[model samples]
Target: MNLYKEPLSRFLISYNLCSQRSAKNFVKNNEVVVNGNSIKDAAFLVDTENDTVIVGGKILPQVKHKYIMLNKPEGVVCSTVSDSHKTVYDLLKGNFNETELYKLKCVGRLDNNTSGLLLLSTNGTFVNQLTSPENEVEKTYFVKLRDSITDKKSYVLKAEKGIEIPPENKSPAFISKSAFIKWLSDESLEITITEGKFHEIRRIFSALGNYVVKLKRLKMGDFILDETLNEGEFKFL
Candidate 1:
């Protein structure tokens, strides 16, 4: 069973009860109490449900759970708050009550210009589960390249460094393993990655001496972008 788990140091820091050093000091000074008993170890584990935490005489609010899936369209920002253009929340206008939106936040971020499946939730535990590197959620993408690809280059892309380009212009920023590329015509390709990084899909092709003409995320975790959910549409998971 997945019990409420968090490092004491992180718990204190997350609740703003104290800075890391201050938290350590609090432990050392016996100023923090867990389950009505003063504890001295900063790394101590506490049962989140059963333990009572008191720091500076204030109790931390218990976090609730939430989850959402958005078909983020190009030009929409995935941020919780934004200053320019429309945000992902803008698309959900009037769909959910204030309480729901208030608790809602993006699980993972997509660049403002990228389009694809975006996951959001207030469920910190589930969010952590999905985002953890150990989980290895596979994300797929449909990419368009500015130039045509040759069979030789395709082999190179699958084997050697492929079409090498500068770091900035590539699709995926880093390639842990040689990428799997399938040619769809000469300029379009489908790729898959178990690990997602900032602008990763775009950077990888750029590094291969090709610029990404269009990019769309096709899947995340086990979910795929349903053809029925048009751009700017979303569905409950």
Candidate 2:
């Protein structure tokens, strides 16, 4: 099988198909066509000649090389653009030229108020490899709690019995074997999750009768937040 490689973000930006932010938004919204089929990820690779590229009713030319990272700060939305609040893109202004920055897309989302390491790239396969459930890449978090954890609670948490079932019920439940928690302080903890679910860490602690006061991701897959990067800063990976 013949394969062609080009960074999806670069392709969209180089063609002047859309702004850097818009191109990413388009891909996430499944507006870009690949081989005549709509594909949602901006990192998707295609055969330049055989694959078709269409954006907002126009065709786009291909280009290459796209990867990025962001030290997300609290209060910023993870989206490409937003009407109500600052988005991750707003922080990148002036850092990259309009042409060079177009098509960059986030690998995963961080809640508006949650902060820390965030990855972006136009390498679809690499993104998938890192986030895939089977890959089970470990994600670490530094969390602060509203209450102190007791030994019993720590035992329970370490036993991985704090997770819930169906994840919506008010009553607490546990996953047979999935997560682990380590206390860093009476009111702080480090959690490692193999599965990424919506508001998972917060929910688990909530079930344990403790509320999460602050949350920050420390690592994802092989990447870690560099000490040199301050909040809202970003780097290429």
Candidate 3:
């Protein structure tokens, strides 16, 4: 009935208590309890924020998922575990407990050198929806080139069709999918790509004989970088 309300059977599955079929059976067999009362209807709605769910004498935890928008800074790794480098998680330690912090995952990772709109979330489904290539989520980047490209239109045409990136450092040669390019100036441009291939944007420019001096992502899908967030700052959505 409300955003926080979910069917008892589905809530059981969301908590990883049981499979969908088993959840139905658990409710039907009077084995599941909600708010101290036996719940026989699998579809019976429970307010996830207020109702308590119990199964097999064990209370199921209602995990609260959080979405964070981080203006990641350079030199910070996008991993939860990194022995030699400062990870993005290091910036988030005080914000969440150890368990919840570790559960957070980067939706689409930004390399140590690349910085801009980065998404972190505890919801695996939300992460998958945004990062999945099947969804074709568009990622926009603000690029600064090492040198001005005189024949920008030609290269832009090539990129629009597709650019072939050579294999390097164990990464196989790949052809980028079609992309949209808008030149901001002689030495700068913004590119929008759907696929988040490894070093894809840099490689695309490299393949075109231009080197990228700096790269910052400005947007991903419907989410744009919050201009107010300074480097390394994050806020919950």
Tell me, by lDDT, which candidate is best.
Answer: 3
Would you estimate the TM-scores of all the predictions?
A: 0.66, 0.67, 0.80
| lDDT, candidate 3, 63-153, per-residue tens | 5668899999888999988888799999999988999899888998999899899999776566877888988899999999998888888
- Against the reference, the lDDT scores of all candidates come to 0.70, 0.72, 0.86
lDDT of 1 by residue, 74-116 (tens): 9999765788868998898798887788677676778888888
lDDT of 2 by residue, 68-90 (tens): 77889999997866888898888
Candidate 2 TM-score to native: 0.67
Q: What local lDDT score does residue 20 receive in model 1, on the 0 to 100 scale? A: 81
lDDT of 2: 0.72
**Model 3 misplacement above 4 A:** 1-11, 14-16, 19-63
Winner of 2 and 3 under lDDT: 3
Per-residue lDDT of 2 in model 1: 37
* Ranking of all predicted structures according to lDDT, beginning with the best and ending with the worst: 3, 2, 1
Error of 3 at 233 (Å): 0.6
